[model samples]
Target chain A: MILNDLSELAARIPDGAKIAIPPSRSGVAIAATHALIARNARGLHIVAIPTSGMQADMLIGAGAVQVMESAGVTLDEQGQAGRFVAAVKAGAIRLMDSTCPALISGLQAAEKGVPFLPMRGLIGSDLLKNRPDYKVVDNPMADGPDPIVLLPAIQPDIALFHAPLADRRGNVWIGKARELMTMAHAAHTTLVTVEEITEGDLMADPLRAPATIPAMYITAIARARGGAMPLALEGVYEADSAALAAYANAARTAEGFAAWLADAPGIAAA
Target chain B: MEYLPEELLICTITRLLEGTGHIAVGVSSPIPGSAALLTRALSNGKTGVTVLNSANLQTLNDGAGELFDRAAQGRIGAFFLSGGQIDGQANINLVGVGQYPQQDVRWSGSFGSAMLYYLVPRVILFREEHTRRTMVDQVDFISAPGTSPPEVYRPGGPYALVTGLGLFHFDKLRARFRLTSIHPGHSLEEILDNTGFGFDYEGEIPITPTPEPDRLSLLRGPIAAEIADPYPKFAAAIFKS
Candidate 1:
């Protein structure tokens, strides 16, 4: 369905929903995250494809995320994510630390409708010890004598992201960032916010057809320009330096974060 | 020949990348990223290097998925990893300090170190700070293990570890780090005082060699420019001299 605004689309996500957020430098729905925070959406189990940065920190700081299953959450060059680290320090959320390949492999399993997928890593890592959910099983197919780690399929309640363009039919043109498509295929529902809604069918054009995600998997569509604010949208704009630094510093303390969010344009005004 | 500490470290790491086919330097790793580029330049572009998110260096069109897929397929020859704490067995801990559930000092979570460590043929563990604090006896958590059990299928593991004080080669058979070379201005006694873990050393250790004049010029010149985009601060700070 076509939603008039981001808030309405954000409101549709129920409390305690398992949501998959795409990684940064790709198509992360920052606008949706702000709306979710504005609507006081809570108890979200945030799944990062392999890892996340600003979006994860924002959700955790706003107390929207209850459980985080991610390979890592870092701000890249900006150093450690203070709010996420603080949350982990206070035991505010359940942290399921994972490897990058494991999360992708799990999502891949879900996309293929498989119960579990066997991977080559995590044999001697502490993740296996800490995460009881992952199991080490003998490779039945291998006549050789090596065991492999089996990751449970991660089927999220909703897959959410932002893209440069979407058609009236709700089909999104993701270009080279196909992980968004994988997440949409794996999750039960897919929610998308586009910077601009193009006129013609995205699938009709041969040049754009390959990268387009058909409307079949999309549950909702909303036009939210500058949606991926603070974070860059690939070719559109660069991640706002002043904003990221401001967020990082303000998020050091809960009070500071609240004060910053009080004046936050997207979150507060929305 | 006199060289800056950063130059020395980069040249030292560049020496380690002699025969590597494809090297991947992850995000926030400016030193290794520079070293990878330097190695590629010296090899006449025979070496394939992919620095993630780097404007000048990355070759992957499909984002992290492509990088991870290539690594899993064993196409990546070497990769770089660092830890909040590194132990005797070469295990790197990217997680926080203190207990498991509630950590006193939490760092950025393990992005792909655990998986890449197991897959990459030569995983170089690099940590700039050489101290008992950074190099612990045993890590609070093991984000990626150095050695897997015999029953586990593992073709890749730690090759060498580069630090500020010196370089240590990880012997998989012994599952221990050996004192290889002491960097200029650092002594065996200083390393002993600082290191929390024990390492095997035979006879008198030689000083870690500085880059040749030609190599040094290349590193400080064109190589410096290549790394500037990904690590502007590091490039400016080190390449200025």
Candidate 2:
């Protein structure tokens, strides 16, 4: 399906759906985030692959998130993610504290259509203690008695992201950020926002074909120029440092964040 | 020569990685990243360095997944991790400062720390703060346990805990920390008074050796430029070359 607008795309995601979003440096659908916040979408289970930045904070700030599973949420060079920090401290949401590789392995299991995948590391971590879903079993292949932790596959209801280019056929050129492909593979549906739609066929070009996600995986697409605003889009643009600094300063408290969100660009328009 | 606190910490970490083959530094760790780069430069480019989110150093094309695969395969030699709270047993608490679900204070959650801490042969735990609240008797939560049980298939674990005050080596067999050396201008009494946990050390603790002039010059010069891309603020604040 093709979405004419951002709101229409955001509307497709049902409340309380388990959603997987890409990491911060990787393209995040910020325009979609704005639309979701405008719609006042609630009870989203946000699964961040490894870690997140402002996108997670904004969702938590809007009270759109119920359960967040991530390795960490920070603003990177901007310091701590204040909204996420406040939410956790206030016990406003359930947190599935995870390590980086565990999240990747979980998604990999889903991508491979496996029930569970045993991974190296996390054998003696408290991450194992907290996650009852994870199991430490004897390594059957080991010569000596050895233990390994098994992680349950993470099959989310939807995968959301921003891309630089896509075609009418729904094929997306993700460049080197291949984690988006993994997320799409592990989720039931994928919704994308792009800066521009490439003419003809993206799969036609030999160089682009290798990095393009074929039309089969994408559920819907929307044109959102500067979609990942404030956050950089790699070659498209650099991160708006001033705007992010302003947001970081304001997002320290609920009241400050609401006030800032009220005047936020796409959010205010929505 | 006068030195900044960050410079001292970077030098200390560089010393820890004297013979390291490859070092992978995660995001937001400017000091450790710089140290790794410094070590690589000192080793005549023999040591491989990977700094995530960096324009030049990070060579992985498959994102964090590739890094994990490499670490699991024993390609990465050293790594760095820090937490909101660290205990006498070297347990790190990256989740929060209070009971789970209803934490009083929350820093960022644990990232690839536990995974890398287990896979990287030399995992150095570094935190700028060395107060009682941070160096707790018992961590509020354990994001990554410092030691594993005898039956666990663990090839790597914590090698040392470095703070602004001093350095402590982790004895995996004993599952405890041993005071190694105190940094210049920091007293052992001060460390003991600020620390909430107990540690063992034989004889008098020695002072941490200062960085050589050539090494210091290298850090402030070429290494500073190398680190500027990923850690501009840190490079600007500390490097004086």
- Tens digits of per-residue lDDT for model 2 on A1-270? 568899988898999999999887789899899999999999999999878889999999999999999998988778889999898888788989898888989999999999999987776566777789999888889898887888999999999999999998899998878888898888999999998897779999899988888889999999888899889886678789898898899999899999988887773212
Please report how far candidate 1 places residue B236 from its true position, in Å: 2.5
DockQ of each: 0.76, 0.76
Candidate 1: which pairs clash? none
User: Which ranges of candidate 1 are over 4 A from the true structure?
Assistant: A267-270
Estimated TM-score per prediction?
Answer: 0.97, 0.97
Native contact fraction of candidate 1?
0.80
RMSD of each: 1.6, 1.7
Q: How close is chain A of candidate 2 to the true chain A, as a TM-score?
A: 0.97
Which interface RMSD values do the candidates have, in the order shown? 1.3, 1.3
- Write down the DockQ of candidate 1: 0.76
**lDDT (tens digit, per residue) of candidate 1 on A84-197:** 999998999999999888898899999999999988888778787888989988888888877888999999999999898999888999876788888989999999988888
**How well does candidate 2 match the true structure in TM-score terms?**
0.97
lDDT for model 2: 0.88
